[model samples]
Target: MDYLALLSETEQKKLLVNFSLMTDSSIFLLNENKELIFSIQAHNAQEKDNKSEIDIVDRDDANKGKGSISFSPNQKDCQRLLKDLYEQKVPFSCSYGHNYSLAGEPLIFHNNFLGVLLFAYPTSSTSIFTSQMKFLRQYLKNLFVCHYEMDNLSEEVVYNYEEFSLLTEISQLLGGILEESKICQIVIEKIQKTIPAKSIAVLLKEEKEDYFYLVAAKGLKAKRLIPEKINTQQGICGWITKIDQSILINTGQDFTSRNLKLIELIATQVGFSLGNIRLSKEREEILLGILDSLVATIEAKDPYSSGHSKRVSYYTQALCENLNLSEEVKKELVISALLHDIGKIGVPEDVLLKPGKLTPEEWKIIKNHPKRGLMIVKNINSFHNVITGIYSHHERYDGEGYPDNLKGEEIPLAGRIIAIADTFDALTTKRPYRKAFTVTQAFSIMAKNQGTQFDPHLLDIFLSCVKKGKIKKIN
Candidate 1:
């Protein structure tokens, strides 16, 4: 409905300047609503245009080259005339005052009234066909309608691009995330940013609750504002309500059904992400329970080493924290440390409980525990990759430790990290053959063997933790 929206101000000014020089008549543009949008006034028409079809008398003598005529319409009368022209919905020419006349043509395209183009000029003294203005009327009418359609198409393309960008960002964010609140926050924020027409929010209801509660909201305004809690509902409550979870986007001003579709897709993604997070959490708890029972079995088999696996787990976590490892890596390493010595179950009780040093035969059986532990956990779907630390915990950093003799850094990162924790706990805890070494004595022994027995980098992190008194996870 707005004519200026399709035709820019700079373009309008250029049209006015060029038309004034060419036609020397007043030209005006009006919207379908009968309001004047742009205009240009040119007074001395007969001198410049030189259209011989006009039968006119100059107001001055022959010495005065060509006299000028100025015509300005009264405000009330102009509005009334434009209203009548708009209502007639057809091309027309009519006299306005004693000397001036108006000609108007409707810019209609595909049965839609786009706007009106008007031309005003002084009337000739004698009646004439007025066919002289035919070329000017047709050209101006076509140009105005052409510009209006082009602007409409440009707006649609821009809107579509914005919608695609918003959906892309939201899709990437929802992948692999396990937080309900984070999903809700992303959905609401993205919808608000894409098309800032109406206020948007994600609301959820718990099973026992009667009403759905607000989670995140973008405020309602003439323009989109920053993300905030106008209703103050946050993500703490749980999943979204079973019914009535839709985005509020009024489709009148700058919105349409396309915007509504975008919001719907975002909400569906949020719900799916929240559901997956809850399901993953439940599975992890069950899996951890089964692993706990295995740990309990290992502790019962060797009473003196009842808490050995737990202590190693504690040390491994401290090293992970000191190294600033990601949470996923840290969790895997902790689980590996707990099950590292499970293969020791296959060793004879006599050998395990011996109060003195073992012979070469007994030592050979003792060295087989790492491979034995690997064999035990190899089939577990979740522990398949996790058994790296379990199988390689005893491997020497310099390619001298065990089974495969894998060298430094060839060892998996989990293997390198758990080795330091395993050795530290073994030295400080009392075994059947030797009394407990003091904490200082344990560190002194391990420090002498860095790079040969442990990853030098991970070793440094563990030793630093001891210095900082952070090696303190307990069962």
Candidate 2:
């Protein structure tokens, strides 16, 4: 077994120790092959052994105790124990020791019989044997009852972890790919790994309305649920998706009601797990939509810079592709470029849309947007790490920029990439304050500032992309 699994078995030992303390005797459980699985040696047993008063029978000893220790399935006691075990189909068997003069039951498992759980005393009287046999039977009954409900929670935890890992795999495959049909199919397949569903479907909220349409489905696909408009309060699945809870169909109870509630205890658990997955997907979509809206709002403030954010985003994506970044990194770069100007929201509209040169005071307020954008993104928790790009997009290579003059390699690489994209797009796009520069003129201006404003290596890559027509210069 793995280390964690072995560590988990320690709880079984603790259980045995507690049993020993309660019964006042050493107890042990062994597999059917007679290997010790757990043990709790009694203090009194150690004392008797130290005194050398009790003769312990070693399994390998030649001078064995005559017929008392022989093993035969046909023996009267063995036959009786086997019959009881077969009849109950449970871990229950009896054994008596000639040396220690004790009687107890062994827990029979699929492979081996668990160790002998014996109670010891003297062996002089028949009445003692009769009473001890009765006590042993009751002890076995109680132990079984106690442990029947044991380890269930631990087992459930294991199942939950497996389900979580599977969901993560599905998300990695479907997230950000922009393929709706494939995303829906992959999600349905992932759900099947957890449960045997009769059918599965995804109902996306329709555009510009309070309705949901069935976009993807599996099993009986008759378009019966297609274009189905459900109120938030109607049906199990509808209510769950609306309120962000889990849904379970009841097939057994109140057939007339159509909203039957059956086996709620089992259904509730399944519903909660599925509900969590649904909520997680919804949260991702909401965050991305908010990011897009923020970028559009920033650009909308100035007619001259209407499509400037989108142009920068396109250039950033091309740069990332030329650099051969991983798919996840490429997606992150696209998002970062889109929000590079988010701080513009904090700048005064008069300064932002000014058709004339700005005064020193106006310039200072404009410069403060980068810091404000960083603060805004940091409040989101998940977007805190990406805020570096928004904050440092205007920093010069020689550390002459505002809000912490980070120089050269001291700035984050993502911030450096965004700086190049933002400058390239702004220089090529016409503004109310000034006419746009030609592609060659813009390149010349950036080349003059290389190593002083932009990283030298990134400038080299930019020139190569421009030469290869990878990044188009628009006027």
Candidate 3:
């Protein structure tokens, strides 16, 4: 660690002041490159009174008017002494003249030479100096090492704290999002805040495609670069995408290993989030295809209701949109509508295709279709939200409905919406028992049973939709 680089200029000056008082000799502190950072002249009552006997000269004063001082030996004797000290890598003493003596010690840490600590004094005062003065010089050297080590430790503690804080913040940000593009964007933003970089990019492999595309980027013109898809066998980003690793490159500066590790952690998190989203979407598509096939089977048995399930799905979606339901809830409603009549497959063809009024027992068998539909999809995890809607779509709004006799708000909102759509589609479509009713006739019949057969608020919304020409009247 470079202790001088870690310390402020004020701290460096304070250190030099303390050393000057302790050594009773003028002090000079230099960097590893032999650049003088600070210098102080020792001034005490004893030194002032003995000024006549010792001619003290401060080399720094020669270039006081200049912004910086350059130290070089002008004499052959001084040059030889400096060379000897450097070769020995230890402290040594030499005379500037007959009266002045200078002692210098090489400041080394971890076997690396940092700079030198030099002290100047008068030779006439050598009789006053005893073994204690030599001991003081050694003590100062050890003290400097201790101070530098402590400074380095403090800096390390601060760096670790900042790293922990940054990781905590990024983890929280990643938790609230699910979209792959949004996740990539959030990761890149957090990285920009945590580290200094000229540019950052998140490359993601397109589904079933062999190349990676730039999904998110910062500080770089992405519009032009993103169009050219990058091959996984190409550059650093491509290599990282192939191996799921992260890298840091600095053009003219060196970054710490910790910074690289943090970037890798972010990349790993983004990759995991994207994988989960893609898997979920694939599973949802499969479930939707299954529902569509089941609906098709139900329609095939009854030719008059060829497009009944599709119409109910469209109506339920329109109702959900008017109610301002979330996308997730709207999706669930659409699936429930598509599979609402799926249980009719269990009903006998004679009763299902009867052109006359159904007997009481035949009517009871038709009501059992909802419960049968529930049993059909009960084992599927994705159908959890639609199961209740399928089972209760035929149940009346009042307590007079069949099966569970669920009353009022006791029915799921999805079940209630499907109930309206199912009735509306049945009334407007030509059935075995009756010809298709006109749009006004269907609405009038539904209006007569508002509070008893349908939700009052939902009924009003459906009526408003009819008036606005939003819901197309089926022939």
Candidate 4:
């Protein structure tokens, strides 16, 4: 017997004894693993007859028969019985054979085996097997009522595993997707597959805003959820939204404004997942915005560098379109290029504005900006993709660069694209140290650097854009 049977036996006697009153009743309970350990005699007081209770029957009494007969429990027999019980499913009926004439059939309820009972009937009373089988049918119905309290443990375990796995997958999905509505829709789709809820929602309490918005919801007739104002105990959904709880309603005559245990349990899980998603998303947004704002501020500090980041951002998007990149990739490229010069925030104002050539040490510090920018953005949960681009934008196409010296395809496509855009914008725009080059002059300078500082094909594409005015001076 497993540990569950042992614990259940101590607390489950009165529950088991109730089945003892049935006419000719015998019960066998199976464990969660389906092992049959004990049997009970509900009413075993009937007498046996002479011709049927002969030598073969009496001799068999000394030991339970090995094949399809009452037998002492062995490891092999236990395993075999467990497998049989599992295959039979719940609420099965079978005869307990004995050598004596008065041996009776019993009903077995299988569900982690709370207890079993056996009832005997005298063979003298009925010779027909149909009458005995009729007695068996009645007991089967009563068995459902007897131990329904124990729960379908095996089924519960299965459902728990499915629910946990679904939550994990949804959490991972949320990590990659940023749109609140889409996140909620995916969550609702996942939940609907497991639970029978007509509608699902994710309500976020923006405490500073002093309002709760329905970020996501599903299964409603309307395309968008109507806003539910947050206050204490307003309405069913309102109360749930405000207090971070789950609400469930089961419609029927017996149900009168009360929550069922099952519904409450499911609601708790849903509410927790919703709240967690809201908080996590809020934190990521705040951090990402701070990083981006700082980078933009740094770029804005010098008049000569004004709109530099934005220009790079625009060119990066144009190049991404030319390359036929996916929407997600293009978005990453835009954000990455926009913040590519964030490391300049760490450079001294004097060095940034210096009209003369820099010393080797100052140049070294300036060169380390990409590495510094990477460190800044990498910590933000939502900007990991942008970090790669910011860190490697200075890398050359001909296997020459600092901060890992990654070259050519070793650099990410986003990084390589930003490198071209950054250099092009730098040449076309006037700086504190140098006059802005004319369009033709900038193109000539870029062409000379092709296959060395810049990717050869990319340089060709850039030159084509110049001739076609796809990339033009911002003047």
Per-prediction TM-score to the true structure, in the order listed: 0.67, 0.46, 0.73, 0.53
Best by TM-score: 3
The digit string of per-residue lDDT tens for model 3 on 239-307 reads: 666776556566664566777887776666666778888888999889878978898899889999899
Q: What's the true lDDT of residue 318 in model 4?
A: 77
TM-score order of candidates, top first:
3, 1, 4, 2
lDDT of 4 by residue, 1-475 (tens): 2333432353444443443333333334434443444544334412222122211222244234322122222323333444454555433233334421222222334434433222222222234433544554564445454445344665667767776687677767766554556766776687667665666676666666656667777776775555665543466655665676544455432432222343454445555666676687687578667756775678666778888888888888877777768878898888898889898988888887788999998899899999889887777778888888899899888878767888778888877899899988998899887899987898889888888888888778867876887766664
Residue 49 lDDT in candidate 3: 16
Q: How close is candidate 4 to the true structure, as a TM-score?
A: 0.53
Which residue pairs of candidate 4 clash? 25-118, 25-119, 26-117, 26-118, 26-119, 27-116, 27-117, 30-113, 40-118, 42-118
Residue-level lDDT tens digits of model 2 in 43-87 = 332222112233333322312433222222333443465455444
Better of 2 and 3 by TM-score: 3
- Model 3 error, position 92 (Å): 7.0
lDDT of each: 0.70, 0.63, 0.73, 0.62
RMSD of each: 7.7, 12.6, 7.3, 13.2
lDDT (0-100) at residue 292 of candidate 3? 82
Q: Which ten contiguous residues of candidate 3 have the minimum total lDDT?
A: 45-54
Tell me the spans in candidate 3 whose CA falls farther than 4 Å from its real position.
1-92, 96-100, 104-118, 121-169, 233-245, 249-257, 466-475
Q: Which ten residues in a row have the lowest lDDT in candidate 2?
A: 254-263
Locate the minimum summed-lDDT window of 10 residues in model 1.
46-55
Off by over 4 Å in 1: 1-154, 180-189, 197-258, 473-475
